[model samples]
Target: MENGILARRRRELITGAVVLAALAVLPLPIADVYTRNLIIITLLFAGLAQAWNILGGYCGQISLGHALYFGAGAYVATLLFVNAGFPPLIGMFVGGAVGGLLALLVGWPCFRLSGHYYAIATVVVGEIGYLLFLNWDYVGGATGVYVPFKGDSWLALQFKTQKLPYHYVTLAFAAAAWFAAWLIEGSRWGFAWRAVRDDVVAARSLGVRVFASKMAAAAISGFFTGLGGAIFAQYVGYIDPESVLGGQFSILIALPAVLGGVGTLWGPVVGAAVLMPVSELSRSYLGGSGRGFDLMLYGALIVVVALARPQGLVSLLGRRRERARAA
Candidate 1:
């Protein structure tokens, strides 16, 4: 029985690795600017979604405020680079550490609560963070801080005139996040998390330390998001309250995870691959000077998807497959 199970898992791993390798090489013959740009955007959001999944999906701790971590990473890296003359490459680690510490600080209190209480706590945390960054003068107050354009400084994380480098970097992060999720899903920590998620009381009865597990998840989740945020800031060459760190930023991370299928390893990746392109198209067609078209489209889509398939895209597909096999 064990051998059979191991064989099946090995086959699945090989197949997935092959698919990912193909995707990594797909850009070798790239010619279209728009297509390359779209891929980059997809990978960035996908990475964010996977990072959020660590806490929201796997641990059943729904955080609507993950942007707090992302924004912190962006601001820290940009500030260190701009003011302290620290290069962005090294600043990435600093940003991740700050985000992880904040996660532990917040998670300790909030994890004591359950269900909606926990959810609401996340909202409050995000709101306070947004307000604080908006008012802080050292980080540019409400105006924002900008990174000097280094045409080709590898140490500073700037590349000579090309989106390809940024695209690859973002893809690498997305891959790392996915692998991390897989590791967590298979480890003893993952088992404890699932037990606690299903029933905290039962988990506690079985000797699971719920608070410690949640804090661990938060720390890991925040680290990935912060790292992604640092990369995003460098890619954009700017950081502002509204742009890098906002409730909307958190929403973007959560949406893909929810839509794709929370708790599943690859769900966020699939969700982002589907959601972001449609969003970009909506923005291109309808977003402009104060136009609300993209917002309308997104709102409608979320509503329809929620009502029609609350279990998410992955669940819906699985049901169809089961039905077909039954037939």
Candidate 2:
């Protein structure tokens, strides 16, 4: 047993090392700016999906309103930077806190209902936030606010030249998010969340505080999603309701988790890595021909994956490993 445990640890460490090494130099090989930009975008999406996974994946609570948290973070940082002259660096954390607070508000009423009812409630709450932002002129209304160009400065979260800084920042956060997930998987909270996931009634019978566990998961999940939003705002230097919030962003953010494997730690990252590049390619190729092509392709892929491999793309690796062991 000891030898087996050591071997697994050895394998995990090596796998982690290799992945980090590859991501470290990921941009060096890609000469095309469009492709590089697509990669950067993928990193951001990976973070968002991973954040969502904390609640949706582990807790088995499918939230279709994650865009609210994302937009909250973006708007918070932008409002502070633009109106209060506060550095976005500071505003990002505040935005994350706001996301957490909002999650508590949404989860308080919604957690009472499970499954699809919970999801529907989330969608409603998300739309409410979107409409409020759309009509509120203080936040630029439907037009949205833009981050000022104050030259390249880390404090301002602005970069004038290469996109390397942005990539590193995202990579760091993605790593941190992944690390958090990893820790949670081993912690008591993680066990409670998983218990609730497997059987909520049984978990409650076991003395688990089901509501509190769900609420904690939601708040933490929202906090990270909000951070992803703030990072995106800084990187793009612009924001709008259509671009930053709504069901589309929610779907896009969740796509990776759905495609990769919702409950698995590295699923979102792998899914985003695969999906983003393909979607970008479709956009590049079919963009001029007509509209909705990209959306159609994404929809088709999701349906096919659901039908053919309900366990998700990551299951393929597990199956291969099982086969190897049998062989």
For all candidates, what are the clash counts?
Answer: 0, 0
Tell me the lDDT of model 2 at 7: 76
Q: What is the C-alpha lDDT of each candidate?
A: 0.86, 0.87
Q: Over all chains combined, what TM-score does candidate 1 have?
A: 0.93
Candidate 1 RMSD to the real structure: 2.1
TM-score for each candidate, following the candidate numbering: 0.93, 0.95
Q: 1-327, model 2: which lDDT tens digit per residue? A: 878645754565577667777897998877777767887898888888999999999988999999999999999988899999899887888888898889999999999998899999999999999998999998999988888898888888898877887878888778777777776776789889999999999999999999999999999999999888888998999998878887778888888998999977878888898899879888888866889898688779888988998988989998998899899
Q: How far is candidate 2 from the true structure (C-alpha RMSD, Å)?
A: 1.8
- Per residue, candidate 1 scores C-alpha lDDT tens digits across 267-293 of 898899888988988888889845888
lDDT, candidate 1, at 185: 77
Off by over 4 Å in 2: 1-14
Lowest lDDT 10-mer window, candidate 1? 4-13
What's the CA error at residue 318 for candidate 2, in Å? 1.2
All candidates: CA RMSD (Å): 2.1, 1.8
